[model samples]
Target: MRKLRELFRLRFEAKLTTRSIAASLGIGNGTVCDYLGRARVAKLTWPLPAELDDDAALTALLFPEDAKAQAERPEPDWARVHAELKKKGVTKLLLWQEYLEAVPGGYQYSRFCERYGRWLATSSVTLRQEHRAGEKCFVDFSGDGVRVVDAVTGEVRVAKLFVAVLGASNLTYVEPVFSEDVATWVGCHVRAFEYFGGVSEVVVPDNLKAGVTRAHRYEPDLNPTYADLARHYGFAILPARPRRC
Candidate 1:
């Protein structure tokens, strides 16, 4: 077990990274992680206890749980488990508990997850994100700008592209404005709602100065004009705050 000794030395003495240790010792990354986890659980250090100086003793000490032959538990119905996971606020731990109730001899949470994960990789498609119809509209500005020419002076200006998307259908409304000032920002929302033929229950906007005057966590400040537009349409303006996304 020369690799095991070197693993301990690299971890506790040299403090090399897992990737570095794996590369240096010619072992797999998973093996390195397993060894490190066992060492931590057994309270092992670089200079192991004198009793485990021998190879056999060290292996036994590190992997006592593996030496005992445990009987296999019943496999979980992963398809049902997968379906349960899609419901809002349902977690793996909760599903595992429910599984244990149905089959008392079923696998533990860790193995249940491992087996379920493998089955999901082979059998399931990625989850679809569903938004409520007319519940919310997400609003943002496109980074790219379009050209605007004044008819009288023939002066050229770069205009910001305002964009709005209805959450359920992803219906989009776009307009090029000279600036993102309060008036233009409010006007864009008005036009967007008119184009959509209805107002969403909530209008989510980026925390720009024209919409969110202050980005405080507890109490965000919305611009008066933007707030007034929301009031007129019977919708609420919700500005995305820092660290919320």
Candidate 2:
């Protein structure tokens, strides 16, 4: 603000060249030019109008992007957007066009998605984890399925992905299995432990059907085979509480 006022003073009141003003103010010549140019375009002069010496007023007069965008753009109804995104044939690009129609100069498509992702991150539920070195390994299935294509038959089948990660170092193991049944689930755990070359103190898993036979608020039932695997591996099994928020 002081620099802005000094720039106008040097140009209009003292009749100094922008380069001279930059040298005197220890600012860039280009910076002085930009500030004075904005002042000129705003029709502001040295000593500025008494009503608008506050920094905010000066900033709005000089750089209006944030204020103008906020005032002119209507905020999206994010909850509605989140719900609508779950429906078929709906996408972020489609939603962004709808948003722009309502507010002609709202955020562009990329910015709209970026902002929505940030909001979802804040509003969504997450299990807070505290991990210690070589203490635990967490495992889960990817919600999306990957397609496996046959080499010559042109056959495609959806594959369920099994993922495991060391809680501390985040060493990851990824494998695609035909199904997330008990056999495949146990096999994946064996492979994951072999890949890490050691077992942690505990294995943490979400309460998927393959691991937890019966879902309960408390005293959930672990599959008998999965329990045997834990017993053989000398590690404890702790299933995550379902529907956590």
Candidate 3:
């Protein structure tokens, strides 16, 4: 039940302001202003048509944008949105706000989420683990090392690949180091966090000797230095089970 007809009467026939109408009908001032603005835009008069007596019909007439078919609404670039989501600190709500700025009245928040989910389902096979934004980052070393030639001394060294992958976005950060020592390992984590622009809540590291001193199924022992790094960064270390990753 609505007093839309009375609202129109109060504005046009009674020469009342939107605030006055809102006061009379116990409605919000913003709502009264919105209704009046829509009526003005729709070129509606004081005495609405008999057909427009129904609130729904009157609303549809005044707010034609809401009456547009769902299919007619603008669609988001799912690939771009998905890519943007992989960046650290990016969320659906933030992306949706940006989308509204670009395409006003495109889709409501709920519809945007539903459609994005449908797109994700059709796009690729995802891992069962649901990685929330900035939640987990998986770190490991590549098996094969690359040889690096010193510029000045003409010395050859095998550089180990320190790999860090964000669980949610699958965005990766890689660096080359000479060894898997605790200093090198902790340095890689720091640099990876800098690259990602933020630290994840949890760091999932493969049971590297530098990071995990002893690997146990129930409770792996993290290297003291690595544990200190975790404490400094405020992230939990969840070492992958030995031989399981």
Model 3 steric clash pairs:
none
Q: Candidate 1 on 62-169: residue-level lDDT in tens? A: 767533422245557777888888887799999999989988877788977875754453342233456899999999777758888999999999999999999899
Minimum summed lDDT over a 10-residue window in model 3 is located at 119-128
Off by over 4 Å in 2: 1-65, 79-94, 113-128
Clash counts for all predictions: 0, 0, 0
Clashes, model 3: 0
TM-score of each: 0.46, 0.63, 0.47
Q: Global lDDT for candidate 2?
A: 0.81
Ranking by lDDT: 3, 2, 1
Writing each residue's lDDT as its tens digit, candidate 3 over 187-220 gives 9999999999999999999887999888898888
Query: Which 10 consecutive positions of candidate 2 have the poorest summed lDDT?
Result: 118-127
Of 1 and 3, the candidate ahead on lDDT is: 3
Error of 2 at 227 (Å): 0.5
Model 2 has how many clashing residue pairs?
0
Candidate 2 residue 228 C-alpha distance from true site, Å: 0.6
Per-residue lDDT, model 1, residue 190, is 85
